[model samples]
Target: MKSPIAIRRGAVAAVFIDLQEEHRQDQRYLVDGYEKILANVQRLQAAARASGVPLHHWAYIVDLGAQDRPFHPVEADGKSAFSDKDDPLTAICHEVAPADGEALRIKAEASAFRSGPAAGELKARGIEWLVVAGVWTEACIDATVRDAVASGFRVLLVKDACGSGSAAMHQTAILNLANRLYGGAVTDTDGACRLLSGESVTVWQVEGSVPLRFTYENAARLYAEL
Candidate 1:
């Protein structure tokens, strides 16, 4: 296989999913390697903007009051601890907040396309491939990647730019994505940047080692020592 999967400028879009402030505040949902993920996301977005590739953001929003009849079927009413209206919580993390002209898609589930026009919008914009990054590697990231592939959009998942509550889950999700689910190449932020710049990187096939510096196990150990 080629080093990193090559993505042409016009055919690919950079997507950041569910990196909301709420997730950051909640230690349980905050994935390990969050700091690195945020930094990488910012780097990826900057590269995307400079290269003229479209940038898109997905935010999960739920209404707590309507527990009996929530706006989104999967989001049971009163189940969501935070609503999108919680400005601080719902706001995209400051490190990677969308800039002017970038579009934000509001979703109520793990898959952004399920409750929003993400699929249609991307199709309309002529996006043939996606470079996906963001929080909760095992949940939202996984869902969005699968959905994107199923919708006929090729995807290159940014491995280092996403995280999960635990290292095990994060690794598992990426393995499933590269091996079973999307069957696409996985790259880190730098790899994505190079690909977007029409360069090549080591094609990251699933392996035994984890490349991230601050893994969930490490983080848990450090926190316990605190």
Candidate 2:
């Protein structure tokens, strides 16, 4: 079996996914206590910028003119979610907006890599570790993290910086990722900031609001016997 990839500061990128304005302003679409999530994301972004780490932002956008497709529940309801390109709904939230040179990618699917250039772009920039934060923890964030692992990139999921409407779902996703389904790690805002600043840190997992660090001592002992 292939061992997990270690996340080093130099090759990591801070990636903010689908932090759209509409999701923040509208309670119907917003995750509960999203303001706090936004704050953490902003902090991570600032830290990343100061550390000279590359930042990438992603937005969820639907093609308004596409035809011959099955109706999504939102479309069947005659409500457009992020369909209009010029609308502020589709724009990244101002609090954590993309900087002058940061790339902002728009995607119609849950995973940013499904149809966009995010995967290739990161590889081209020599980024092998992804520090990911964004909204809807069980949806886009989950999809992105899984695909990132499948596509050969190590992921560090920002636990406190991601928001989801359902708290249970959010926790479930975090546990799933940290359990090594995709060999991804989870960290809070402070840990991510520290990592961005070139500190070698153990990636932590959030379990019911408590942070736990991963260790190999038990496995190391077993291997030593062999």
The Cα error of candidate 1 at residue 107, in Å, is 0.5
Q: Per-residue CA lDDT of candidate 1, range 4-47, in tens?
A: 45666688888899888777686545668778889999889988
Query: What TM-score does prediction 1 earn?
Result: 0.80
Best by TM-score: 2
Model 2 scores worst on lDDT over the 10 consecutive residues at 217-226
Model 2 per-residue lDDT tens digits across residues 129-195? 8899997888898888888988899788888898788666566666556655355566778778887
**What is model 1's C-alpha RMSD?**
6.3
Off by over 4 Å in 1: 1-4, 66-79, 82-84, 181-183, 205-226
TM-score of each: 0.80, 0.81
Residue 17's lDDT within candidate 2 is: 87
Residue 82 error, candidate 2, Å: 5.7
